[model samples]
Target: MDFDYDLFVIGGGSGGVRAARLTAQDGHKVALAEESRMGGTCVIRGCVPKKLMVFASEYPEAIGYARDYGWDAKVGDFDWSAFSGHMRSELDRLEGIYETNAQKAGVKIYHGRATVEDAHTVKLGNGQTRTAKHILIAAGGHPVRPDMKGGDLGMVSDDVFNLEALPRKLLIVGGGYIGCEMAGIFNGLGVETSMMIRGAQILRGFDEEARGHIADCMGRRGVTIHTGCAPVEIEKRGDRIWVKGSSGHQDEFDDILWATGRKPNTQGLIAEGVGVKLDRRGAICVDDYSRTDVPSIHAIGDVTGRVELTPVAIREGIAFHETVFRGNKTPVDHELIPTAVFTQPEMGTVGLSEEAACEQEPTLVYATAFRPMQQAFAGGEERVLFKMLVSKETDRVLGVHIVGPGAGEMIQFVGVALKMGATKADFDRTCAVHPTMAEELVTMKEPVRVLD
Candidate 1:
């Protein structure tokens, strides 16, 4: 059947943009509808802006280290106005780039909400209906705020980037990566930051040792972390917000930020009405190739609730293009993905955690925790950890986890080795770069413990 376009993509996130651009580049007609900005969460409100804040927050520590190194360095008051203005400008430029690139690739841009009318039809908010041979949904997700009394007075991660001024006292809720990262950023920016975790520990899904080290570092850095507790009620009194914790504690703060979690963006798309299967979390259920239950429809990125990372979404989009356009029948490989949490010290990990490794089979753990030369020389008490998990029988490195500076960059290279199935002997055979923290990866010859 003849349609208005070959592809009609709902949402302009990383995955949606990539799919539209590439499919159009292949000479197929495409139209993309985005209710909001072009760059979606990662480029606009998420990774880019958040990472910039993380960099901004690290300056005070850098100044301290500079002073310790005998360089005359002092940190002045942070200028929130200047930084936020510049950040908005940067975001605008990035959004323009996304739009320009999509236009250059000959994809039609509809700047309004789009809903699925059927497997091959979409109705935009502007009272226009467009039909396509295929439809791709990449609507992404949004941060969730708890449904409680006076919760509307609190802010979410998105709201943090738009704050007019940094609060003198900030209360961050949730124990996930977002909460931990924001706590670190606010604390470093000289805000009296306190984190309320409903669970016993933060970063619940991460490696236990790495999460514990991060919690300790955050606490040492002056973040009042309250674990196994949560705010039962929030009250706003003029400029101050008061929180009553489940553990019978109460406090007032200038800001209350909820980093609780995010939910899939499938509200008005009507995927289920058009025979698309949705999981319990409202994420569209798709096969390995990102094809939805309906043959003419597909979904990717956070909307699919599979590997909710930007890079993963891009990869899935590329795979979808290959399978549909290039006749390559490619499926996204979502295994052994290396991830990093940008807390104060940072945590980078790949493959299995120690718990997962031991649960599977006999495992040998090689681990070390000590003060690194740089911090030690600076007369700082901060320490770093590097750990490796290896299978006793296969001798293959099962996992590598690091909690320290440069852990993120280090894990990127380590991820390549793990992806190539490098064994413990392979790491041992590699020569050590002397006096570097990463050298321990190659030099740790003896197992700290072997799990039977």
Candidate 2:
């Protein structure tokens, strides 16, 4: 019953690469196929380069505030071409690292798209096939482009990173995290930016107050926010790209970026070839154990359309190996995962939203908001937003949401506490860290409103 390899992974994303590494370390012969770059979407076009631009944009804004904090500021110029050149260099460095890691772990990395030929075999675009005892689909997701007139005049998520120079004014289509982050980056770097989302608010799933605050803060920071609007068509005249959407809303910009949404990268892979199932949204179907209808085949990450996050992908990839290959049983709780949005001010949240908790049970909602010390020092009007939802009956902390500085850095540990089923009392009993904004979590007064 020996196979050509123990595992054959398609897609070298966080999930696929992680699976290849871990399973190989576990002494499983593994070969992974990546149609594009070694690092997949997150490393190539999405998170890595996007975040580097976020840092570059924020530094200029930070420099302006340094003088108010009694620090002398040295005049500096940021050349977009030069900065982008370095970013590309770092990306190439990461790509090499991924190759080195795969090679070190004894993974046969194939630089071609893969298709599932059967339950235990995958055929590559390069006309080679590999047989494995187990197969994992971690192709990840990509930005979805809408069909409309002149839509090609604008760019989508992938094209944004390829820009040789910054645009003067940016009109962003779709108000998801991608749109919001792009808007924030351009605005921070002194570009006139406007955001348009089909939803009523920017982030539709989070706490209503937090969503409202995000919109208000964006306005307060000079980025235009337009909600409940859908783009009808795109037009170009001279150097300006003009977008006309539903309700006759017309906006023009030097550059247009559409962050509308992402589709699971499962357009192919021969799901039906082996009787694997897919959800209505075109995502590979998987259970809590990530096993598809076909027992030997499995799926994870955005392809599964479960929780579309990088960490989730990696964790699931590793957990999958533990359950199947290593004869150990471990699972990732799909709920209450911590995540961050890297916009102008940044936002972090863990666990359920107040809206979600209240829906489960009319619960207690205790919230606090303020201006951080940095904003105070810089005389900026942006405010920090923090809130927690707790179950009135069980006293369990149901959710934690924050919009402000260090939101990502602060929510991670809280996420761990939540996964352990820590109660509100546990948070309160925990000693507060002084001279820190995070301390506010432990020091908040009693519940603002406890729903019976």
Best by TM-score: 1
Question: What is each predicted model's overall lDDT from 0 to 1?
Answer: 0.92, 0.86
Segments in model 2 whose C-alpha atoms lie over 4 Å from true places: 74-77
Residue-level lDDT tens digits of model 1 in 1-452: 89999999998989999999999999999999999999999998899999999999999988999999999999999999999999999999999999999999999999999999898899999878999998999999999988889889889998888899889999999989899999989998999999899899999988888899999998999999998899998888888998999998899999889999999999877744689988898899999999988999989999999999998999998998999878999988999999988998999999999999999999999999999898898999999999999999999999999999999999999999999999999999999999999999999999999999
Q: For each of the candidates, give the backbone clash count.
A: 0, 1
Task: Sum up the clashes in candidate 1.
Answer: 0
* TM-scores of the models, in the order given: 0.98, 0.96
**Prediction RMSDs, each to the true structure:** 1.0, 1.6
Q: Per-residue CA lDDT of candidate 2, range 1-452, in tens?
A: 77999899999988889989999997889999999898888898988999999998888768878888878994486688898889999999999999899889999988889999999989989778789999999898888777777777778989878888888898888777888888888887778888888888887787788878888888888898777777787777787887786867897789888787888887876846579988788899988889999999999888998888889898899889889888888785678789999977888999888778877987888888887887787887778888989888898888998888889998998899988999889998999988788988998877777765
